[model samples]
Target: MLLSIIYVIGITAEAMTGALSAGRKNMDWFGVMLVASATAIGGGSVRDIILGNYPLTWVQHPEFLLITCVAGIFTTWVAKWVVKFKGVFIRLDALGLAAFSIIGCQKGISMGLHPGICIVAAIITGVFGGLLRDLICRQAPLVLHQELYASVSLVVAGLYLGLLHFGVSDVIATVSTLIIGYLLRMASVRFKWRLPTFTLNMEGSVH
Candidate 1:
């Protein structure tokens, strides 16, 4: 129940941020809702598909879809305020990322998946929504280039698994992962921490 509540909050925040992205592009209302829904649910959908978990969240609970659409329209009205409080959204996104990773890891564990596959599930849940949003908006995918985005997902998933391995209660593990993951994400953003980029120069001598 706690996880479900947090998931709702996560998707709401993600949808609002996605709406802001749509507003930046001067999209129509339909476009706003489309992007918002995609950003809010795309990751979970991908995770479920990969895990062969039928009846995705939005499919099972249509209200969640409604929530994202409403959040998107709400953001359109408060677009300026949303921009002004971008820092708050960043924090919310970080929290959401942690929650998503934990949820994904839990799903994989429930399915008796390998630890590595669980970590990959976490990464998918934490990263792909933003990827979809950026693709729809024609912006560069932030997960590919941003500060420790996917890395944070991996770390949080590993930490959650480690805590479980040590016999920690689920509640404790979830809370600890959330706190640490959020802090790590914020710190990465503040310090401009980034993964090394791989650039291939085909400039002079490739046949």
Candidate 2:
């Protein structure tokens, strides 16, 4: 049930971000919907494919696609009016990250994955959707930036993994991770806190 709610919120936020970007780029309705759909399901689709899950989640449960479509349309219609308040978008994105990261870590642990791999998977799951969204919109991926964005996912996933390692209940671990992730993200944005970027005096490769 918690996972379901998180999925809905994540999908809706993805649609909203895609819609906002599309409007800013002057994309047509079709292009907007494409971006919205991609942002909404790109991560989960990739994860399912990696896990060798056939038919994918949205494919097996087509209602998810319908929900994404409706959210895309709704965001497309309202984006212009709310464009000035981009902070709302950021907050929604952070919340989505917190929710999805916890869910991903839980799923990974349930599937008997290693704690380290589960943490990695959780970070990927949280960031991949937004990364694709930005890429499709011709912007830099959020995870590639010198921000506390992906760090939030890693921190939350690490906490969850630690708890699970100690044999904590799944619900408690998931909720604790989600709350900490969300709070940290909100505080980071509010205080403009970010992970420091590494710089080399040699000015060599950028990787």
Candidate 3:
């Protein structure tokens, strides 16, 4: 139940940020809602599809979809305020990322997946929504270039699994992962910590 509540909050925060992105592009209301829904639920949908889990979350709980749509529209009305408080959104996004990672790890464990696969699930849940959002908005995917975003997800998932392996209670493991993950994400943002980039320098190679 706690995880479910956090998941709702995470999706809602993600949807609001997605709406801001849509507003930046001057999208219509439909576009805002579309992007919002994609950013809010695309990751979980992708995870379920990859795992062959039937009856997706939004399909099972239409109300969650409705919440995203409503949150998107609500963001439109508070565009200026949202922009003004962008830092708050960043913090919320970090928290949401941690929550999503924990939830994804839990799901993978429940499915008896390998630990590495569970980490991948966490990465998908934490990162793919933003990827979908950027794709829909025609913006560069932040997860590919941002500061420790996907890395944080990987660490959180691995830590959660490790805690379970060592006999930690589920609740304690989850809370610990969430706190550590959130702090790592925020610190990365603050410190501009980033993975090394790969660049190709080809000179007149194409015919």
Candidate 4:
């Protein structure tokens, strides 16, 4: 029940962000809905495909799709507020990422997969929605960079899985993962922390 609520919140936040991107591009309502739905559910689709899980979430639960579409249209009406309060959205987005990771980790556990594979699923679920939105809007893939986007997912999934491994209660494990993952994301954003970049000269030779 708690996870379900988090999932809905996560998708709604992602859909709103996606709608803002579409609005910036001056897209029509249909385009807004498209980008919104893609941003909200694209990650889960990719995860299900990778795992060979049939009947995607939106397919099985069409109301979730409706929620994203509604969120997109709703965002169009409140674009100004969304922009003015993007920081709040960022925090929501961070929470959403944590939720996405937890959901993906749970999916992997349901599938009886290995811990490493679960971590990968969590990262994919947490990262791919923004990737899809960027691709649709002709923007660069933001989450693919060396920033902590993927790292947060990794740590969240690992910690969640680790806790469960040691027989932690589901509620405690989920809540702890969510809080820690959110803090890590906010800290990274506040501090501009990123993985060290590697650079090479045009004439640099491979070892």
Candidate 5:
């Protein structure tokens, strides 16, 4: 129940962000919906495809797809507010990333996957939606280039699994993971923390 609630909120927030990106590109309503839905659920869809999970989440629960579309359209009406308080949006995005990571981890655990595989699943779920959105919107991929995004997913998944191994209750493990993951992401943003990045330029020498 707790995970379900977070999943819904996560996708809604993701859809809204995707809609904002579409707005920046001056896309029409259909384009907004496409980008928004892709941003909201693309990660899980890709995960299922890779994991060979039958009947995708949106396919099994079409209502989730409807929710993403509605949320995307709804964002258009409040784009100004969303832009004005971009900090809040960032916080929500952090929460969404945490929730998505936890959910993906849980799915892998349920399938009796290895801990390492679970961590990979979590990172994929947490990062791929925004990745798809950026690719579609012609923007640099934030997860690839920006602050500690995929690392947060890795941390959350490993922590959750470790907690479970130590005999923590599911609810407690989940809640603890969410809180810590969110804080980690926000701190990365506040402190401009990032993984080392490699750069190449015309004037730079390379091996």
Candidate 6:
């Protein structure tokens, strides 16, 4: 639950960043708000649907939508002043990634799944929402890039699993995972560490 709040806050920050960017580029206020709301919640909605968790967070707590909209308005209004510190968006995004990864893993564990499944599910939960946002923006997903993106989530998930095995409380495991994932993502970006692109040919056919 704490992780969920962190996830919401992280996405909210991203939404604001996206809104400000759009507004700076001369997008109308409505367009800016729409883009912000979409970026903030689109991924989680899809994740809930896929996981068969009916009545997603936004649906159950309609305030999620209301909050997102209000945040969009606030971002649009203040974007001109806030655009100077663009680097902050990266930090917020990393924090969000870590929070969501822990929440995802914890959610899976609560559902009584196997450890491996829980870890994989956690990684997906952390990433799927951002993936949706990128798809809508017509950009490649972060994990699909050569960056050490998904790897950070995977590592966090592994760490969370280890913590659980050692009988750590969910809160402890989650907080630790969030920190690890956030730091890993930040370090990867700062150091320009990334995964290698792979190419394979099968029987003269490129796949």
The alpha-carbon RMSD values of the candidates against the true structure, listed in the order shown, are 1.2, 3.0, 1.2, 2.3, 1.7, 3.5
Best-to-worst ranking by TM-score: 3, 1, 5, 4, 2, 6
lDDT tens string, model 6, 85-109? 6678778888987776676777677
lDDT of 3 by residue, 1-207 (tens): 777887898899899999999998999999999999999999999999999887988999999999999999999998889889989888988999999998888879889999999999999999999999999999999899979999999999999999999999999998898899999999999999999999888987985
Over 1-207, each residue of candidate 5 has an lDDT whose tens digit, in order, gives: 987898898899899999999999999999999999999999999888899987998999999999999999999999998789889879988998999999899889889999899888898899999999999999999788888999999999999999999999999999999999999999999999999988767675565
Candidate 4 stretches greater than 4 Å from native:
203-207
**TM-score for candidate 1, residues paired by index:** 0.96
TM-score of 5: 0.95
Better model by TM-score: candidate 4 vs candidate 6: 4
lDDT of 4 by residue, 11-82 (tens): 999999999999989999999999999999999989999999889989999999999999999999888998
- Give the top-scoring candidate (lDDT): 1
Candidate 1 residue lDDT tens string, 114-158 = 999999999999999999999999999989998999999999999
Q: Work out the TM-score per prediction.
A: 0.96, 0.87, 0.96, 0.94, 0.95, 0.82
Model 5 residue 116 distance off true place after TM-score fit, in angstroms? 1.1
TM-score attained by model 2:
0.87
> Candidate 2: misplaced stretches above 4 Å?
199-207
Candidate 3 minimal-lDDT segment of 10 residues: 1-10
- In model 2, what lDDT does residue 46 have? 73
